[model samples]
Target: MTDWARFLPLSNRDRADDGGVSRDRSPAVASLLSAIAAVLDARPDLLAAPTLRPEVTVDAAVRELLSELGAPWWRRWARGVGALESPRPEVAAFADDALASALHARAAALAGPERRASIHDLRATVVLALELNAAHGAAIVVDPLLCGAVALDLALRSRLPERAVVTARSLVATDGEWRVGRGPELPAPGGAIVLFLAGRADVPPEDSAH
Candidate 1:
């Protein structure tokens, strides 16, 4: 199992998309691939099972992973999003029945043209990957400390709803040295708080934590 967390540094905030022009941001791709591999390797049964992370199933996550990974070009041909995301030839082309072939081809495709997809979309995949990684446990995450810190950093950077209760949270990771919040501390495994923030895991919010 690969450690998907250390694939990118926790401090990396420089990867926000820039006009969707073109750049090869391979780190996110590598990280996501590593995460997916780790997840599947540990629990092949999850391929047909519910990830229990809301709308996404592990299989669907794989399909979307390919779609998002290929968005650089297919997005242009996209007629609609969400439910209408399918029928895209690019995605269809990548969606080989053989999952390994699909993932391999897509990885090569990302490095093909200068037209790059959004790295944020890939990060979103990481969160979903975590939902899958939940079954795999700490082994899949090579650097839990870094992953936890990065996860918290990501939660803080994410846009919250208007008057959202989760805003300004001070989260502490019991398994690591990372802690953030001026108010009464909300402590848990660093990754769980992150999953909760993403609505991937159901963890109740504690007192003021920002």
Candidate 2:
């Protein structure tokens, strides 16, 4: 017996009341959740009031899981985002550029120009960049107006609606700056643009970006 197998009965019982459960009760979901639970248990501090502080618990759980999985520092840093959590409007705009940079990085790594780019791969790269930026409290800036719209679109679409709500406004470059809202003047064309998404402590307005 796997740890997940042990929890299947309980999960089934919980679902029994609602017409005996659906795919939600599938073994894979149970196993993954159980594994996450085990990881959280190993860190009591993160296990604090999971029901009351689900986001906090999730953040901690993700961080722990990333560490346990031996993910790279960048990947680990990016795990701070919770599903369904939205990025700040300002952050979303900046993320467009960052995502573009990540995409470019991926493109550059390919052996040949003819190597096709998968939207999924590009989206994953951007997602990682988004998480890393949030965790480090820093912004990423790519060179002037790199395919930002496309990158942002892919990143936003790639997110699981049940898990995260990342969104962004249109990015318009004028005099070498990507502008969003009246928050502050964007950096110069060649400078870095910081993202201050929703969950970040420094930003205001707690509405979900969905």
Candidate 3:
């Protein structure tokens, strides 16, 4: 399974309709990605946390991730954000079904066909990056230290007031206290999701078969 937490923070602060463009290399995004990568490289079991840490708020973590990776497209797009985003038909044409589904989901939520499409494309790109990392035999782990209970609480309350409290109660009860790192092995279910913010998932085909 892939880590979804690392990428969760990158959700645009402003919906595309409101002229919110997400930076691809913000310090916040970079930091979060770095933290994830560091933990993955050392241990592959920390992905299972009761809740993320206080400092691991979705936006802050995503900005940190953008900073760590050299990719500046997100930053560029965010700065030039207008009613429309750049067209990426070729990208859309190339994505697979799972990726396409996710991309379509984001596109439908935002405004501006191009911007919406771009959001979907970017999600696929992130997924591909994780695939490459896994193929390389890189140890994958989640940062148990980053707690997200508070942020999740706020998000649930704001987005789904009716279900937020109930959902939060369930997650908090099922998951224990969030911690620092994981042991040698992760404690998640088989095929659990890993929190991957960003990395080089688009590796060359030839290079992938190491």
Measured by lDDT, the strongest candidate is: 1
Model 3 earns a TM-score of 0.24
Listed in order, each prediction's TM-score against the native is 0.59, 0.26, 0.24
Model 3: per-residue Cα lDDT over 1-210, one tens digit each: 323242232232234442542332122222333434444345433222211333333222223222222325664455346422322333324323223233333333334333322222333223322332444333433222122322232222233442332232222211323211212222221111222112211111221222
lDDT of 2 at 150: 25
**Candidate with better TM-score, 2 vs 3:** 2
Residues 131-160, candidate 2, lDDT per residue (tens digit)? 333443224332232223223333233334
The predicted structure with the larger TM-score, 1 or 2, is 1
**Candidate 3 global CA lDDT score:** 0.29
**lDDT preference between candidates 1 and 2, better one:** 1
Ranking by lDDT: 1, 2, 3
Question: Candidate 1 — which pairs collide?
Answer: 3-142, 168-209, 168-210, 169-209, 169-210, 170-181, 170-209, 170-210
lDDT of 2 at 182: 27
Query: 1-210 in candidate 1: lDDT tens per residue?
Result: 423233232322334632432234454565556556555655666666666555555666676666566455446246334445553555556433455456555555656556454545555555666666574452445234444544544655544541142344446666555554334567677667656666666654443443
